[model samples]
Target: MRQTIRNVSPMSNEGRNAYVIEHLTDALLTLLRDHSINDVSISELCECAGVGRASFYRNFESKEDIVRLYINHLFCEWADAYEQGDDKPLSALIQSIFAHFERHRDFYGLLNERRLIYLLKDVIIGICGPKPEQSKDDAYAKAFVAYTLYGWVEVWFQRGMKESSEEMAGLFKMQGL
Candidate 1:
């Protein structure tokens, strides 16, 4: 999900690139608190991150790529935790997803406030949507599940996310969704 310039080779120095990525990510999120992604120039971001423009260009293609990559990184982390957990039921999975969002409420709340929550749809779909190898019915089912999950998250954010993750999972159970 992290989009980098094609010319940036994977053989580049890993440690330095990781440092640059972390700093840029933090800087971009900090700036996003007070400015739209469009309002913050790449120079401003580089200066805030204490990295040069070449580093920025080396790591990311656009400001939005930073957000996309961060969200994906967070989701991958959540996925790892979910995989390690024992309970794998539908309701439990729903609660885990909501809890993951709850754990990062500030970041998510900011996205909601900025009307950028739509960005999350891609993350969800990329993780859960149909794969090419699946049968048509299976693929359709996966797509349905992914979209339905996104719908719940969107409504939850729209409602100011007052309900606890447990309550949201309970609603899913009650509705048999």
Candidate 2:
């Protein structure tokens, strides 16, 4: 849903805060897709989000701040699902993540670049907590997960999202992440 951060009572600070967070998320996705992460500017972002500069600064120091918040929301949901103690929880967790990438296909496409994907993986790992094993075996697991989902989303989009989400999830699970 589109978000608006204006017209709410200033006294209801909590609601206003939520409004700003959601608003910035929508704007950031559009701006990043159009101008990319490296080119997007704070003024342009605030303009797209329809929030004032001061309000933007109040909520996010920069575009990355807003982007990080949105990623964390997805991470928290995935973590919660994985933490539910299902067999092969990591697979279940990967399923939750595939759904997320499916939603943000445009941004996921941008992450096809290896550098961007690794950067994203680091951010996600940092936010999601409980890092993977610090062994040679597990070193690439987190990065691989991020890259796989991003690439999968690109393929799904190009293929017109032909499979149902669960079907795609199952396909991803079979990949043995």
Candidate 3:
């Protein structure tokens, strides 16, 4: 049973991919609030989104891929919001990230509980981008940064996010990152 998806603008020429991604993301986030990603089946997700099972496969390799693609989308948004000649401080970037996550706190909190936060790894690496001058050590540093941020985010979500996004940003600022 396929359900029609509306309200999605293709982020790329891959209109079908974009459509599936938007609907799948909505369904996954909605479901993650109540269930672990590991427990989510493709059929259940497709049913929730009113999308077809074949469509889901065409857009995503697995359930975790949805989270990764969504994170990619978030990173693209953050990058787009940047201004040329801007300092682009790490604190500013981290703040934007935390603030964005705050908007979907419940969804991420559940994912953290299920230890699916590791899914952000690829997204982080992608954000690191391709630096021609990047050395092996730089690659390690990038991975370290990604994993560290993931840990802090998981902790924040697990602790019920008592700190406001500003406070979280301040914490990083104080650490000189």
The numbered model that scores best in TM-score is: 1
Residue 148 Cα positional deviation in candidate 1, in Å, after optimal superposition = 1.3
On residues 58-118, what C-alpha lDDT tens digit does candidate 2 reach at each position? 8887777776677667667766766687566555555566666667655655555312443
Residue runs of model 2 more than 4 Å from their true location after superposition = 1-11, 87-104, 113-115, 123-177
Local distance difference test, per candidate?
0.88, 0.65, 0.75
Clashing pairs in 3: 3-50
TM-score of decoy 2: 0.59
Q: Model 1, clash count?
A: 0
Candidate 3 wrong stretches, greater than 4 Å:
2-14, 83-85, 128-132, 135-144
User: Which pairs in model 2 have colliding backbones?
Assistant: none
Question: Cα lDDT of model 1 overall?
Answer: 0.88
Shift in Å, residue 167, candidate 3 = 2.3
Name the lDDT value of residue 81 in candidate 3.
Answer: 71
Q: Write one digit per residue (lDDT tens) for candidate 3, span 1-177.
A: 533355434356487676777888999989887788878899999999877898888777899888877777766776677544478777776777788788777756666777887776666556643345789878777667667677777788778888888898889788665
Between the candidate structures 1 and 3, which one is better when assessed by lDDT? Answer: 1
Write the residue-wise lDDT of candidate 1 on 1-177 in tens digits: 233675345655897798889999999899989988888999999989887899899989998888999999999999998899675777888898899999999999988877789999998888778899999999998898889989999999989899999999999889775
Identify the runs in model 1 with alpha carbons over 4 angstroms from their true place: 1-12
